[model samples]
Structures are given as structure tokens and as C-alpha cells.
Target chain A: MAEIITVEHPEDPRLGDYTSLTDVELRRRREPAEGLFIAEGEKVVRRALAAGYRMRSMLLTPKWVEVMRDLIEAADAPVYQVDPALAEAVTGYHVHRGALASMQRKPLPDAAAVLAGAQRVAVMESVNDHTNIGAIFRSAAALGMDAVLLSPDCADPLYRRSVKVSMGAVFSVPYARLDPWPASLETLRQAGFQVLALTPSAQAEPIDRVAPHRMPRAALLLGAEGDGLSHRALAAADRLVRIPMAHDVDSLNVGAAAAVAFYAVAHGRPGE
Target chain B: MAEIITVEHPEDPRLGDYTSLTDVELRRRREPAEGLFIAEGEKVVRRALAAGYRMRSMLLTPKWVEVMRDLIEAADAPVYQVDPALAEAVTGYHVHRGALASMQRKPLPDAAAVLAGAQRVAVMESVNDHTNIGAIFRSAAALGMDAVLLSPDCADPLYRRSVKVSMGAVFSVPYARLDPWPASLETLRQAGFQVLALTPSAQAEPIDRVAPHRMPRAALLLGAEGDGLSHRALAAADRLVRIPMAHDVDSLNVGAAAAVAFYAVAHGRPGE
Candidate 1:
């Protein structure tokens, strides 16, 4: 069980992690080295607990402490009980969701380890938008994709906005970063996975026609919304598939397109 | 051809339709009883033009007007050219896109009208987030879903944020409101459509097993993120189907889920 502490001062030193969050540059500068990330609302806080993230502390109003008692008790951190107004003042926002948790960020698994036993996976390159990252995780989790592998340029999956947009699925879906770009893709191929690059190019095969049984393990590679996959990444793929789109439509948003592709590849697999 | 009009004053009465947009209440109040909606950025403006919405007027910076010569020449409304700084001052924010257009809103098409000749369609109920509404439109268009029909509570598909988020596909997709709640769903069945309600319930059939060819027309019924479809709407469908989700996952965001469902229903058919 976690210790319950009462805090009245808005400028308490313990609350520093939650302060000035709207200042993007300051938050980014402090976040990475500090190894801390914030999870807001009851759903995400519960997920943080379930994911085995080491909780540092929690801030909540008395009402939420009661409502979320099961979750607070499951945490190993101190739960700071504060007045709603004081909590709002400390956090620099209204804090209407009533509860928040701060946890130590976990290191991602190795890309090879993430693909070792996976049947279907999503590989992202240069997807910098946090909301898109979150939404893709939510889709990957809901559609039963085995794991998500990211290139170095991808946004932090644990970013506050990503966590909120993913509706807590970021905690459940396993993801890891792959360094050295297209060279690292060889790790997936070594594990007998077919890397299918998703593109809008006319020469690509339609996604549905690819037989499921031929490739027991598959990786669906996606890129950023506008520029799409880099030339190097496209060249490295085992095959390229296009989700046939209407004329004059540029492409689907990266995240939404990922969901469609994930479903097409992951669907109908046994045990799902 | 659009007549060019020079506007020097930020508070000019002619700019009333484009002013106070950041104020939600004021903007809502100014909305035409049937047709007042805003479209932002050059691409969405072009889509709006292609969709045949009667443009009330356009506000553009000199740089944008020069760049969009072809689009401006195709417009039927007056083009008001202003300096970038003045345009920002009038709109209450930095107008980075350098262009905006106001259009008279159109009446929600009758559900029957939108469903006519449609093989695959999405029916939304209480999916009120504007960005989600826009994303669904983008997915529906890209995946070849023919139309989107909204329940009365759904957000305005033509809202500026929706237009921008949908990548302007909201302007192209046909949509109408279904009043009288679940009762309106009967209209779809009468049109030789089998209404498939998307739910996460364990008892529902897996989406992949759904026979697409048996029904010449199908409507996918989706709901908001949290509450999902109301009990009444769920009860109205011909059959319930679920996307096979992984362990401990609750659901995808309604918009993302809509994309997967749309792709499955549209692409699952025997022939393209």
C-alpha cells in the first residue's frame, strides 16, 4: 500500500514534476533525463499501475482518492491529497479529471526481442506526431497486433498527449525503437518476418490479395503522413502494399491508415 | 471569376462572418440556420469549391491570392485580400495557412438520399468530437466507403476543424442526420441494406466472418468513444459484429475504430 500525504502549498518541492507543463520546451528538456512521465485521469493511472511502471507519486483530490481507492492502493508511491483548487494551482490547470500519477519511464525492449515471437507487428518510421503515435497504439492493441516497432525519429509514446490520446493502450502495447534505420530491419527478416512497406505508389500490390499463411510472421511498415517512408526504408522492404484509395485523395492520415492496414494484416489470424 | 476586393480595416463590417471565430459561442450563434460553416487552409478551400458549396466570401493574404490564382479564378464569391498581419488580427490568432473561406451550410441530406446507390456506408450516433468526425470522413473516403450518415447529436462534419482534420474529405462525403433515434435505422433496412452494428461485446460475430456479398448494401453503425452505441441503436441492427481485440483492451477511439470497420466492410467483398 502507498503512503497518503496531505499537501496544501502550491509551490511544494515535491510537486515540481507536475509544474509548468504547458511550457513545451522546458517540459521536453527536463522530461528525458529525469526519466519521468506523467499519466493523467483514472483510466491511465490504472494502466500505469498495471504496466509495472515504478510510480513516484500521485496527486488527487479527496473525492477521487475515494473513487479510485483500489487504484491508489495498488500503487507503491505516496498519494498526495490536495484541495481541488490547490491541486489546480500546483498543476497549472483545472485538474478536472481528479487524479494523476507520475511514474519512472521504462526503457524500451530491443527491436529483435519485440519481434521474436510476434506474428503481426507494426513498424513506424519518422512518425513525429504524438497523437498519431497514440492512436496507432490504440489501434494496434484493439486489433490484436503483436507489437509496435518505431524508428528513432518517432515521438515518445509515453508523452502526456500520446498517453491521453491512446486511452491508456500505450501501457499495454509493447513498442521499441530501432536505431540505424533500414539496416535494423534485417533483424525482423532474420526472424523470418516479411516486411511489407505501406505506400500509395501505383506499383504496389493491394493489401487484401496477400495470402495470410504464406508469411507466418509479418511486419507492416508505415511512415509519416506527408513525406511517407524514406527512400531507404522503401528499398529495404520485402514487398510493398497499397490500400487502394479514391482518385484525388492524397492518403489517409498515418494513424488511421495504420489501423486499416493493421486490421487487414492481423484479421482472421487464428487465436485472435 | 471572383471579384477582388481590398480590405484595410480589421473591424470592417464585411468581415463579420469571419470574426470572433475563436469564441465558440459567438461562432455558433453566427452559424447560418442551415448553411454557415468555415473552411480553412488552401486544400480544404479547394475541396469546398469542388463540392459546390456556395462560397459567401474568401479572406486571403496577398501571398496566398497570388499563389492560388487557379482556385481564385474558379470561385464564385468575392475575394477579400488582406495583409497577413491584419488577417491574423481579424481571426484572433496567427493565420499560418494564409487562407480561409466561409460557405453557406447545406441541409443534412435525407438518409435515403445519401444511402442511394451506396454499397457500403457508415452510420454514426453521438460521435460528437469534431476531429473524430473529420477523421471518419477521411477514412470513409480513402477506403471507398460511399457515404456517412450522422445521428442528430454528431458534430457538424463541415465544422472548420473537421474539414482540416479530414483533409477536406468531409466536403466530398455525403452525410445526413437521422432523427427519431433508432427508429430511423429502419429506413436503411427498407433500402435493401443490412445494418451491421459494431460493438466490442463477446457475443458478437467476428468482423472477418461477415459475408459481404450476401448483402448488396451495408451500413456500419458506430458510436462515441466511451458510451458506444445507445441500447436502442444496438437493438436496431440486423446483426452485431466486433473487431477481434487483444487481451485487456477495451476499445479503439471511435474514429479509429470506424476506419478499421469501414475497411473491413468495404474491402471484404468478393470482388473490388
Candidate 2:
């Protein structure tokens, strides 16, 4: 079902998708342009395939070949077997998980399409950290958030780090980019979703009291780690909601905050 | 009040406390044996001091010298100012945070001591990842969990990475190691606390339905990321509870689960 090619040279052009992966800036630009994302490790690579992503190719060490035998047998894409040393040289790090797959990224749906079938949503603004975005996606999917709408400046969810950190959750959660940001938020309101901005502002109502879970349709807006939602993003929301914090903590990290908020909004809902 | 020393040599004995920071195994063993922990970046350093940890010494780049002048003037500990390159040479990475402090570690309170005045508590078992422990501490502190009790195998909360990742919340929240672990958990039950084991098992009650927040005194037990609560640990708990996860996620990362659990246990409680 698949062709296994033995690759010895680090410079092989066929391995282009797997090169310089540790160079985040280079991969960040190259991935979206080339319409591919790399999924690392057996679990994530398998998940990517299960989610209907087309595999461009796979790079695996000898030991992993047998471990991933089923996937290799089912794949139509070429599998390259390489020595671990060469794999490390090409990727700029030790490929500890022993397997990597380059998956073709499908075009993201428009915001309207993503929101059409979803009742609970997470709206993120300028959440550019790859790890934070990945963690949020994992929580969003796990907590039953229906969809994710990202500001144009949000980091690529399919970035290698994001995908790995998310444990391939990026493949599971349907997400779309809101090109005009705060202005595009009006579209959520028109869809009968109440947009609540999540912030640490003292003046904001406590999220528990807002009882987002009671809302028939709710979208919670979140921002980046340190500098939270921009003025316009805050102004656009129907209400400002803050997670009640104690012990004088300035705020929870974005991932923890997103998880708590997602849980809060999804709590008390009937089982799906 | 503090002596200002300019250290030019990377091999200087005075900088021993800050050596080989990137080597996890080395630092993990050394920090605890030496009874000191490192606080990196200005905010964490200030928070550590504010929490009453005595500074053994401080490592600062030239720029940080001014920013930390008030601290330097108030401390009796020696402050070593080094150039960035030398700081990098000594610590095994770029000291991007520009400040590092080696603070004395106090003797941890016993489990019974930590449980004495606490109503909401987090008990972690074999959660050896420094980042996860730090994150859990941050969430615990922010969510108003009164104390943390750790299985003896859990990572040190005062390890440098834990301190940095916790944003010094580790210092704010008191924690103790339960020497005999699952057996020691009985002390919590003895203290009139309901010990709730957080698991993803289908048999476990959903955390929300359990209403941990309504419990007069509750202790949430968390395990490591992958192999959650050892069978023995789960068997010891008064009840088994789980976050109501959707989309067939295997589980939330330990940090997120801890945050959500902490919020649930502390929700609707009187403000501290």
C-alpha cells in the first residue's frame, strides 16, 4: 500500500518537508505557503490520518517502522526510512518520538460555516504563542466547545509545535480565521450568540455569575497570555466576564484560563 | 544593605548556585540538596522575596542592576553582576530574563500541618514534571486552593523551572510531601476532608454533579499526565470524580485538570 524508500543523505530534496523544523520562523512561513503541516510521534501522526488529513509523506526510523506498520500499510504516501542521526541533523533536534508525517492542510472554513453548527465557541485574539494555541485547542475540543474563531494574527494551529502540544487536537476542532477581528465579532451576535469577552479587569462581572452555561448560544472571547484583549476587542463584546481569581494572582496562564472558561461555559449543559 | 560584586570569571565559586541550569537532572538533585531554589526574572524574584524567602545571592545582567536597585539596597545577600555572555556561559543558556536569585528553601510543613487550616486542597501523586507542578501551583493559588499536598515522588515545587513557571506562586502557596503517599492520604480523611480522586474512568461521577464547591472541606487528588492515578491511589480515595470531557478526548493535561478541579472545589465559597 506504500513505498518504503531508504534515505541516507540529509540534503535529499525529497525530505524538504522535514528539514529545519526547529527553525520556527522558517517553518512558520513555509508550512502555510506549501499547504502542509508536520505531525510528530505515533499518536499524533495516526490522529492526523484518522481526521482525514492527506499524508504527503512520512519519515520514520527503523524501530518505528514496525510500530507504525498498520499506518504504513494503509498509506498511499511514500515512507522514508532514515537513521536517527540523519533525522536529527535534518530536523535540527532529536526526533524522540521516532516518527513524523507531513499532512496536507485543508483550507479552513469561513467563520460563518464554522459557527453554523456550533452552540459554544471560543474566540481568540492575537494568541500567537504556538504552545498556548495548541493547549487551548486541546481544551476547547475536550470541553465540547463547538468551534474556534481566530483573529488573523493568531498563530497557525497546524504549526508543528502547536499540533504536537495539542496532541493532534488541531485536527479535531473545526476553526476559522476572522480576517477583520473585532468587526467580524458582529457576525457572532447576528448568529444569535452572545459574545462575552474574558478579561482580568476588576470591573468585569465574575464569569460564574454570568452563567455562560445557561446561555443558549455563547461565544467567549480570549486574548494572549500577558497583554489580554485589545481595547476594541473588549468594546465589541456584549459583556465583560472575568474568572474570579484569589491570592492576588495577576491572572492564570492563557491555557489554564481557557480551560477553566471552557469548562464554565460547558458546565450544566445536557450531555451530547 | 547588600554587597555589589562584579564577577567576570565563569568558573567563579560564588556562581556555583547558578551553574548548569539547563541540565535538569543535575539541577533537580542539586537545588534540593543545597536547600535553595532559583527565582528567575524580576517579577518572580520580587515575589519570592515578598513571600519571605531569604535570598542567598542574586545574578543580574547590567541592565537588571538598575531595575532591581531597590531590592539590592534592601537585601543583605551578595549581588553578582555579570555580562550577558558570562551569564550565558555559567547557566548554559541565554539569561533572557536578565535576573536570577538563589533563595533559601524553608523546611516544608508536614502534610498534617498544611491540612490544619485548609478547606480546599490539591493532592498530587507522582506528578514529576516541573512545568506541570508549577502550573498546578499557579492555578491552585489563583483559584484559592488553600494548600497542596504531594506524594513523596512529586517534583520539588522550589526547583528553578517550577519557580519560574509558577510565576512564584509556588512561594505563595504552601505545600508538603506525604511521605507514605496513599497511606498518608488517610490523614486528610481524619481531618474531616473528603478525598476525591480525579480520574477519566467511565465509572467516575462527573465533577460538576459531585458539586465539590458545595462540600465543606474537599481535597482533590491529581496524578501525572499519562498514567493517571495509580490503581492503589484511586482505591484509597473516598470518592472518584472526573471532569466531564467531550469529543472523546483521552484527558486534559494535568495542569488544566487541576485548574478546573480547583475552580470547582472553590466555587461559590466565601471570599478568603
Best by TM-score: 2
Interface DockQ of each model: 0.59, 0.58
lDDT of 2 by residue, B82-186 (tens): 999999999999999999999998988898888898999999999999999999999998999999999999998888888888988898888898879699899
- The regions of model 2 sitting more than 4 angstroms off are A269-272, B269-272
lDDT digits (tens) for residues B6-86 of candidate 1: 999999988877887777666655675535888898878877878888889999999898877887788778899999888
Top DockQ hit: 1
Q: What global local distance difference test value does model 1 have?
A: 0.84
Best by lDDT: 2
Q: Fraction of the real A/B interface contacts present in each candidate? A: 0.64, 0.64
Give the TM-score, chain B only, in order for the candidates.
Answer: 0.93, 0.97
How well does candidate 1 match the true structure in TM-score terms? 0.93
